[model samples]
Target chain A: MSPQHRALATREAILRAAAEEFDRLGYDAAPLSAILERSGVTKGAFYFHFPSKEALASAIVQVQDDTWPRLTGQWRDRGLDPLRTLIGLFEEAVSLLSRDVVLRAGVRLAADRDVGYPGLSSAHLRWEKVLGDLLLAARDAGQLRPGVDPEAAARTLTSAALGARLISSATCRCADFPERMREVWRLVLPGLATDEWCPPALEVLAAPQEP
Target chain B: MSPQHRALATREAILRAAAEEFDRLGYDAAPLSAILERSGVTKGAFYFHFPSKEALASAIVQVQDDTWPRLTGQWRDRGLDPLRTLIGLFEEAVSLLSRDVVLRAGVRLAADRDVGYPGLSSAHLRWEKVLGDLLLAARDAGQLRPGVDPEAAARTLTSAALGARLISSATCRCADFPERMREVWRLVLPGLATDEWCPPALEVLAAPQEP
Candidate 1:
């Protein structure tokens, strides 16, 4: 491999190590030495790629942020209904969070107080906007019930999803996240969707495959 | 004051200071020196009362736990409907969390990653049981719908409340916690309660006074 290709590979290895460290031990408790050991990279290579722990954490957040558009774009390309598309996005997240150390670490780092990252709230705001826009679109398409405020629904749903994820992580190591989210939708959709949309929404939630 | 009374006061003061420190700086970053400075107590006196920061955090959790029974007892004594009483209990918590630094501090400490206090999960378990019992009563009293499972509802509501409180604290310093909770109940109640209970439940939520 070219020297540049090797450099990129080393950078990716360092980030993966940092993400796992943050996910397992949290930001404050996770040490740079452990990350270096986990990555099997010397301190020189590590610092050459990422200067500080904060920089490594920020890169994780950035990488996590980059995934959102790609995930959502895939659903949008499928031409599914807006609400189904939203559920699809979250389902994708749940799957990623369950298996992907980098994404899980990104979430942990975002919420870690000692890390001092503001990305968590911004991420919430972005998701709220995305969900709100989708709900509005569903309403426009006569999918949502009349008089249901899309913004309020979006805010509540976002909060509920976040709460569910946290509780799942704490109580069950997120083993039941997809199931918990299904319960959230079961309770929330009735108030948001018209009768005609309920069946398909449930179908989307129940189906194992991506839309 | 008697010497015993003075000691008790000193202990209380130290706990308060520790709680505030943990709440503001989080567990990993909060220093014992800052706690001592905040309490205006000597290091010796602080150590005399609480052996360590972990002990101080445990004491704060204990104090927060003690408040729950007293608050719930007050609602139970009023002979209010079960659903209303449940709402009252949470309403009381919101009020305390708003004005009481110690309670807010306890919550922040419980959620803090570096703290690692199992008391937090136990507290959640306790609340879930309390809520589950209340929800079962509400179901029996015909306040809740016939098919709803009280245990599941209780778990969801507990998780949702925790999530909402976290979001509120981070986003608004919990200035809007009551309003945020109101929205939670607004969305959750329709699924849990019968139609007849809706109006009264809404009224219970709207009332500023403790029921």
Candidate 2:
């Protein structure tokens, strides 16, 4: 590997180990010594990548934030309609949350009141905005129910998705995330989408997709 | 005041102040000294009531658990049907969560990955059970739509309600709880309830209550 590539690899190692520590313990309890030990990286290398535990936390959240837009952009490029894009976006999130430790840790840290990283809650607001914009497009495209409030629907769906993560992880360690999200969209789409769009949206959510 | 009354008051004071500190600073950051200063109780008196900070955390969660049953029983005694009963319960919870610091602290602690207290997650499981049983009763009473999964619906609603709390507090410190919950039920009930009951449940959720 090139010098820069090796450096990137070391940083990834530290981040993976740190995310595991944070995911297993929380921000308050996850110590730097353990992260370094688990990563098998020297103290100098660890400090070179992350100055503090909070910095590691910010890195994990940054990874998740970057993942969201990229995934959404990919789905958007598929030419799916707005309502379908929302469904596709949620499906991708549920799948990623189940497998990605860094993503799960980012989510856990965001909800955790202990983590003081300033950038944490912004992810949630960004997500709500993303959902809102999609719902607005869905409405304008004649896909949403006539009385559905886009802003309220956006926040409600965002909250539900967030809650789905919390309950799923707290209980089954996120093994049930996809099923939980499927149930959320099953109920929500029926009320939020127009008659024509609701059934098809439900069908898409009910149908399984390749990860 | 009588000696017994004085002791009770002191304990209540410690609990209130501790809950305030926990609510503001989270579990790890909330110091007993700040709680003591805020409660205006001596260290000796504080120890007399709560053996440790974990005990204080337990007391807050206990208060919330006790309130759930009492509030639910009161609503049940009003002879509400199963579906309406669920609506009434969630509405009360939303209102209570907005103003009750102890209750909010319990919720915060329950979701906090840092808190090691064993009792925190039982509240969530208990809540899921309560919602499940109610949905089951509603199904048995022919109040549900065809093809609705009661267990999934139960878990879905619990997750959504839990999510509403997290988002509300994260953004607006829970002033938006009522509005958040209203949007939740508005989106959830239409898909979960039968044609006859869905509209009325939405009405109850939408109409302002006496609280």
The alpha-carbon lDDT assigned to residue B14 of candidate 2 equals 90
Instruction: List, in order, the clash count of every candidate structure.
Output: 0, 0
Checking candidate 2 for backbone clashes, the offending pairs are none
Q: Which segments of candidate 2 are over 4 A away from where they belong?
A: A1-11, A33-55, A110-120, B1-7, B41-54, B110-120
For all candidates in order, state the fraction of native interface contacts they contain: 0.27, 0.49
**Candidate 1 Cα lDDT to native:** 0.77
**For model 2, what is the alpha-carbon lDDT of residue A183?**
85
RMSD of 1: 4.0
lDDT of 2 by residue, A1-211 (tens): 9999999999989988988887766676788889899999999888888888888888887787688889989988999899999888889888988888888887667645434321135677788898999899999999988888998998888877777776676566677889888888887777898888888888887676666
Q: Where in model 1 is the C-alpha error above 4 Å?
A: A1-17, A32-56, A76-79, A113-121, A209-211, B1-21, B31-56, B73-79, B113-121, B140-142, B209-211
Model 2 chain B worst lDDT run, 10 consecutive residues: B111-120
Model 1 per-residue lDDT tens digits across residues B1-211: 9999999999989988887777666666789889999999988998898899888887787777788888878888999889989998898888788667788777766555323321134566678898999999998998887667788788778767766666676676666777777877777777788889977888888777542
